[model samples]
Target: MIEDKNQQRTQLSDLGEFGLINHLTEHFEIKQSSTLKGVGDDAAVLKFENKKVVVTTDLLLEGVHFDLSYVPLKHLGYKAVVVNLSDVCAMNAQASQITVSIAVSNRFPLEALEDLYAGIQTAAKIYNVDLIGGDTTSSTTGLLISVTAIGEVEDEEVVYRDGARPNDLLVVSGDLGGAYMGLQVLEREKEVFKVNPNNQPDLEPYTYIVERQLKPEARKDIVQLLKDLKVKPTAMIDISDGLSSEIMHLCKASDVGCDLYEEKIPLDPQVISTCEEFNIDSTTIALNGGEDYELLMTISQDDYPKIKANPNLTVIGYMKASNEGMHLVTRADTRIPLKAQGWKNFND
Candidate 1:
């Protein structure tokens, strides 16, 4: 029996963003002595007196984070590790080990599990991280993977969201927006396949970009390089939420402002061409398109030469006083206030 819609309950939109977060999390409280802070920042920080530990976990669902139709089991396994490791790297800590938990339905066979484990082993080897423990369980639905990563750092070496100082140079590792473009290419091909299954996708043209999306290499090397170079980023975050959103995080957490240049945002030639092919603004893609998994950070101006000379790094902008503003400066010399367009699962 259908009820009167006019007499129905309150909508989620009526609660708004902060209201939802508060309502959902209000019931939970930190119960562990080691838990320094929880669910309030980029990553949960824990202290053990002599040393500090950073803990982060991520859950990737079958249809949401990936589509098995196009993604290989091996790549899926590796990506599962990469996503969690990316978070540890963002905290400016070296990942040491991971615990992988999988929940799979009866549809997946033993051979498929072996293939997935093989990929996980490969990623563990590549990152020099140990797979210490995990849990395997049955599921009523599709595949679900959860990974919890652990890393250690000296109490002084740990960097958090609330550390950015004014005048720091905002930098990022590698290029941006390639992953979004890659997804666009894959989705277009999937549509083509739906129309006609026999048509082979010309994925060769987008190998690099597609790989960027499918099996991204974690920026573990960059974290190691920063340690070797003795450059501690004032504040740091990863690019999973799009550049605009991440920049806002750094600003809000650190009580600072930022000025990012449109031109300085790194873009590979392939990404530029792909954006043109799709008739989308590359700048917009870099700003709001998510899941690049690159490092977004700020360093001291004196440390600029260190990051500047490195081919792996790109100086895209600078931090400013909190009262100034956070914005993007276009090539036309127009300055527009920055805004976050982060991806939302609920909205989709």
Candidate 2:
């Protein structure tokens, strides 16, 4: 029998903060050996051996970062954790632990929060990261989530954004623009829903793009693949804020220029179709669309041979001298200056 989602709704006041915390986190077991001490303590105790530790944190707000009307609690929780882990992977590290803190208003039922934690637990299991400790608190308005991911990497294996040189090859893991296209689809459906509450959305056609936006997987496998291929990236960053924005970040940090090939930028078939349906430029979408969570890295020219045959990666561009200036070479051979037009959370 199908479970009724609304059949059992418990108020937040039914379980106080402490009781709620224990109830939600009871299922998480310690799986990481680095975790000396987990939950139910003043603080989490961790021990990293000889390798260097890397920590990354992210804050997700209801209206600012996400919309509950379309985003399910579970997917939000998973995405929240995955985004932080993506940062760790960008450094060529293995994420081992996470601390998830959440604040929710009284409007949310205990079951809703359980759904959120279910997603978090699933992400922790799949990513192989232990949820050590976190805090649960009350919020006056909407829900909020904060996640901190910790990982380890050898000193020599750590990759930074400022290491790209003039001759380094710019490579990207997976295609871009699908997530942004997915957001467009969701927003359109949301608008349609507002007009006709009884209408069901036909999301089957946009399943791939929708999943790209709602549940993005970090490039953890890409990191391991790079290691197996013996390809050490000179510089790297997770593509959270569009390819153009990330490329600019790498260029500014490394004091170099880039020549991104418009034809070479990868785009999923769904992304292309959606762009056409929306009357938007596919290249523009790829450049400015954000939240792909793919690894953007610069590898040495000598390492090109190793990655050339790798289906998981694509060489989109090549770095150049700072004096050359960053430009996008059009398919027609026209060189146009590249600009960052990614999302600005503060602009609205």
Best prediction by TM-score: 2
Evaluate residue 41 in candidate 1 and report its C-alpha lDDT on the 0 to 100 scale. Answer: 61
My TM-score estimates for the predictions, one after another, are 0.84, 0.98
lDDT of 2 by residue, 60-123 (tens): 9999989999998899999999999999999999999999999999999999999999999999
* Steric collisions counted per model: 0, 0
Per-residue alpha-carbon lDDT of model 1 for 173-259, expressed as tens digits?
Answer: 999998889989988888888898878777887888998988888898889889888999989999887899999999999999989
Best by lDDT: 2
What candidate 1 gets wrong by more than 4 Å, as runs, is 1-50
Please report the TM-score between candidate 1 and the true structure.
Answer: 0.84
